[model samples]
Target chain A: MSDQTENEESPLAGEAYTLTSEPKLIDGRRVLGVVPGKPSTGESKDLIDEDAVMVWPHLLVRHAVAALAVMLLVLLLALLFDAPLREIANPNLTPNPEKAPWYFAALQELLAHFHPLVAGILVPTGILFGLAALPYLDRNAYLKPRHRKVAITAFTAFLGIWIILTLVGFAFRGPNWGWVWPWNEWYGEL
Target chain B: MKVMDRVRHSMMGRSFFRAPDRVTTRDVAAGHWANFFLHIYPVKMRRKEISFRYSWYLGAISTVLFGSLVASGVYLMFFYVPSPANAYGDIINLETQVAFGQYIRNVHRWSAHLMVLAVSFHMARVFYRGAYKSPREFNWVIGVVLLLLTLLLSFTGYLLPWDQLAYWAVTVGTGMATYVPFIGDRVSEILLGGPAVGASTLIRFYVLHVALLPAVLVVVLAVHLWRWRKDSMLDMERSEP
Candidate 1:
């Protein structure tokens, strides 16, 4: 099929640049090399296969480096920061301003301003559906950042909002979940 | 002299991992095929696929972080009990008395956080690269599910320590489930096993955290990897000759 397409695309295939009789293996798959020059009578082939590296050493070495770096970082973190374990649970006594885990802090923040149904259920579900439907919605084959202007802009905005909300929840919320300035004494309630 | 060198190489290789002194075509093919782990990978990859500048290796790092979390979690579990009566005390005993227990807990906590970040960033990386298009779409969806699983795993485990922090944090977190309109109360009740976060909640969270969620994640991850290998890296598709 490819040979037919190549031949059809090239009007002067036999006259301009003849096909090489020799077939070669590329990335373990057999491929026909096209000799793009003056037509040759003899069977001399020029390999036009894309250059690639064996996964064994090339990709494996990088994977090894990544593994080592992650291990070292985790070790350093474990040594430096002990996991937080607060006072034992007491049903009668609640922390002045209870908070969710940091990752959910953004959603908590959203709940502070918007209705829980909208903030917690609707928005998150929308985001997930949006993510899942992205490939189908945007069928453009190009990957360059400039070509995907709208996607890049919208995603960046979403990330910015997420970070801002998380920051507000993490550091700004205080007693009764009121918005407190970071430098204020009420922040100590956290 | 060369024969003596070959003998020395064989002797040294026998002491360690056995391998030929020089790599050949057979060695390259066998390197992937003969090894259980390496067999997941294709023998040869496009130069662009291995380029760090493109991927920054976020997905691989996320997998490593997840592995670390599981290892550290299991180690910590040896010193932990899920019951509300002993959960906090067990954590304290583990930290102060058990050797490397604090380290294990810390690694598990930090790695969990890192895995969340890594997985989220990996999704972003795939999105920006437009790797989710065409044949790769389902794998992208699988990745999204994995991301959700990572978050749920982290959230469920958040209640394991049974500290005031864990109890109340979970209270606030699960309270969000009550906003689902009609089924909201039922969802919250089901999660807590009642109207509140109590012993039932802790045990439920513990079971889901350690056994159920991790098992699901592993099964889904296998699918993710199978698709990744079968489809090859997206760079192969994007790169021009």
Candidate 2:
């Protein structure tokens, strides 16, 4: 069927063309006259095929370097700063500020303003479910951010707000969960 | 290179490798396919996909940090016990008495913090790159699971030190759980194994940090990587045309 279409479209349709030698078989198909020009699909398709590369050395080498770099950073950190060890845990005496880990600082900050149910349970659950549902929710098939304005905007806004809240909860808040300059009165713990 | 070639031709190497020497692209691909460690990786990827800007290698960095944690954590576990009386004392003894204990503990601490950062960055990178599209959607979900697991792992390990920071931080962290309408108390009870963060809580968090969560993360991470390898070659962007 493709051959029929090609023959009909060919400029040499009505002209008599002869093979220089006996017709050879290629890939179980009778050899037609070899066209000595670019493929109909164009050069970009071939370039796309060339874009793929073996992962053995190409990717593995990069991964190895990354691994080494991270290891070195960890080592430097370990050497420079000792892991903080405060007084032994005293359950009867609670710390004043009573902060959570840095990662959960955003939720902790939210808890300061909102009800525990809203800030703790509902918000975190909503975020998790929303993240898991993102691909299905935003059905736009475009890969570029410019083509995906809504998703990009929503994510960036969430990211920015979360980061700010985390910084506030981790560093800015002091005793009684009151706002304080981090440099003056540092309450942040590892 | 010559030495590697000679080894490849050796009888022992031939028996071990089960593939021809890496002379051509096909040979390299065959060798990659035959290796157990490389099973998690696709044999080939788009050149752009492998570049530094594409991923910033955050996933790789996170995995390496996990590896560092496992190594350093196991070493620390040898000198410590999970009890109210001994936990803090053990840490003190380990840091002062045992050789390289302080260094190893520091490595574990820093690695845990870095792992959290790397994993979160990985998720954000994946989001901005629109890497969570159709064929890769499930992998993205798996990634979310990983992020949660990373947080859980760090939180659980935080209590193992038995310091004041660990105690109060965990208390504040777990205190939020009681806000859940139903089964809130039950969840907190199950997690602490008692009314409050006591000996029972210490042991519970220890077991979770050292044993259960790591096992689950390993399994989930395996599935995540397997799916990644399977979907690596898919042209999600081009499929529309």
Candidate 3:
């Protein structure tokens, strides 16, 4: 969510009650926070109030660092290799039976038989359009697996099909663009 | 009532098994430091709701795969020359000659396919969650543009091989482009460089696959991310602290 949403959601909460969320020393000396929700001994810093929020900075930092590390490694590699660029493209040799990179070969294979609008343009567009509209679709507030069975199952089925089709496409379809209709080929990728 | 029972006894009933240690009342409480940002929405009405389901992870995971593509793609670039004569040979050499060349190509190829799936799945997850409610409408549009960019990247990269597959695939793909009215032919001409996918086409795709498209994508992605941050993260239960 964005900051705008935050303001909209918290119009009254911030003003509902005044808590010494942040305590400061008075008389320019030191002000001990009289936290209404604190451990009686004050030795343990555990918070006890529903009004208090606890955040794990380390967790967010971990995510941020992981993202940064991966991206940096990619950038460095990119600087080193410069990706392969082929020679002059030949149009006369049309039907060059242009297969997509091995990765996209399946879709290219699908496009090989299906129309571009359907395989290349239409279906993919629909999927994206569908994604952007998700917030309005599944609004159930349950985070547990039991509450999200449909979501989990649907995602798994989708990935399963894609990966399975890809492996199957790679296996049955030889380098020459051949294909097979067997489930065994869905076992793995090269 | 105990918080555990409160959670376990909700309309959907709490999921006791999902990170039980971390699901303390504080995790869902209002106003906390560090993670105050997550509480962008009111919590009382949240009712144990998830943000966009675990499906939301698809987007983050897709971003990871995209990162992998950019890496391996760059590595493949080192030995690849944009000339038609050398393109195929270079690919062969990368496979048979260069160190880790085969691995790089394999990873690049696989991740490219993976990204396509991830992007599509990510979109699907978003749609399923209806996270596009009220104020978040425009980001959805931005997402659509990003999807187009992803496909365009995939399409343009298809011709970089200069093999039978590259030549024929691009030929068929661009042939469709030529059908557009008005400046269709011109557009195809611009795409192929000199009427067809030749040396010019190779260079065109080279420029596009590497420089042009990435540049555009980066800008758009930055905006998309900025919007996400500005729009508040899609958190479940508006959990803060």
Candidate 4:
């Protein structure tokens, strides 16, 4: 039959103007039917082949190797060295430096510097809370790392500064309340 | 077969999912360095790639540190008791005997320090990236709670060693907690388990360090992670630096 004749005699000629034609995936519970004209190409490939993707091997490689590497080293070291456990609870005697585990020494240092609420309770608490709350706060539609350069740069700089200051505290300063600088210390007692 | 050759490919839906079947950082990491090193489990961020930078690695570093702590912590647990009465002595024993315990202790100690720093850096990364906007607001809140829990975990862990540093630090810490108006004294007592860092306080801190806080942080961290999956990673493709 001619195309025009078929069109004229179509099942419902009254609905001819409203009729349209296209194909889409059969996203039924049982099967996802394919849409017509969307020839196989580009990034749409992963959706077409479910069987191959189900065994997502890359994810396993990323998580498995890095995690396992660290664990093994620590375990071997634990086996090799005995961790220091302090003496039985004595309510009395105090160690000389009275130093905190190195990390808290900064807070110990800060607690030394400011009120406990600010250093111990508030600031650290606020920062941590602020950190966890971050994803909820900034909802802009910038996905690629490069697109959000401001955020990236800021984060990078902050991290750099933080690390520098932390190391400075651990390395240059003593357990004393004194805040020392190179020239300042040379001129002072030491 | 290459992912591009498949039939259902779409060009516009890049934001929907992390174009599965594409070459990931893990694939490259494996291809590049797979030949060497220990067993490295590359736990790919299940969400979209937030950024392609070194800073992104900070969160991963924290995970590594936590893993270090858990492993060493378990070993230390073998000989250490949590009682305020026996806590200090156990520390001494681990230091003196049990074979190479000192290194384990140092790693645990240093990693705790590193975890705080790493988490802080990871937070800063999220913030400047504007990754905290809109859909991610709840996750940000979760991150904040996790942050507090991390600090609390660190604080509680401090007293377990029971050395002078532990004694005085907690002394000062709990002492400071009492500054709150009505609850100052009450809170201090609660934290101290009586009035000062004594038997009750030691046991309290031990339970907190070994049990309570970790559970909370892990749960929160899980949520924090799951939300990332939901909102997708906040990789802003516009900014540079």
Question: In model 1, which regions exceed 4 Å deviation?
Answer: A1-50, A183-190, B1-23, B233-241
Give the worst 10-residue stretch by lDDT in candidate 2 chain B: B20-29
The positional error of residue A160 in candidate 3, measured at the CA in angstroms, is 13
Give lDDT tens digits, candidate 1, residues A104-139.
888988888898899889988988888888778877
Error of 3 at B124 (Å): 0.8
Deviation in Å, model 3, residue B206 alpha carbon? 1.0
Q: lDDT for model 2, on a 0 to 1 scale?
A: 0.89
Model 1 chain B, poorest ten-residue lDDT window? B14-23
lDDT string for model 4 (B42-149, tens) is 223333342235235555666777777787778888888877567677777777887867777877876676678677767676666565666567776776676667
Candidate 1: TM-score?
0.82
- In model 3, where do residues sit more than 4 Å from their true spots? A1-190, B1-56, B233-241
True-structure lDDT of candidate 3: 0.59
Residue-level lDDT tens digits of model 2 in A104-150: 99999999999999999999999999999998898888898889899
**TM-score of every candidate:** 0.82, 0.89, 0.57, 0.61
Q: What 10-residue stretch in candidate 4 chain B is worst by lDDT?
A: B34-43
DockQ of each: 0.37, 0.38, 0.11, 0.14
Query: CAPRI band of model 3?
Result: incorrect
TM-score of chain B of each: 0.88, 0.97, 0.75, 0.75
**Steric clashes per prediction:** 0, 0, 47, 73
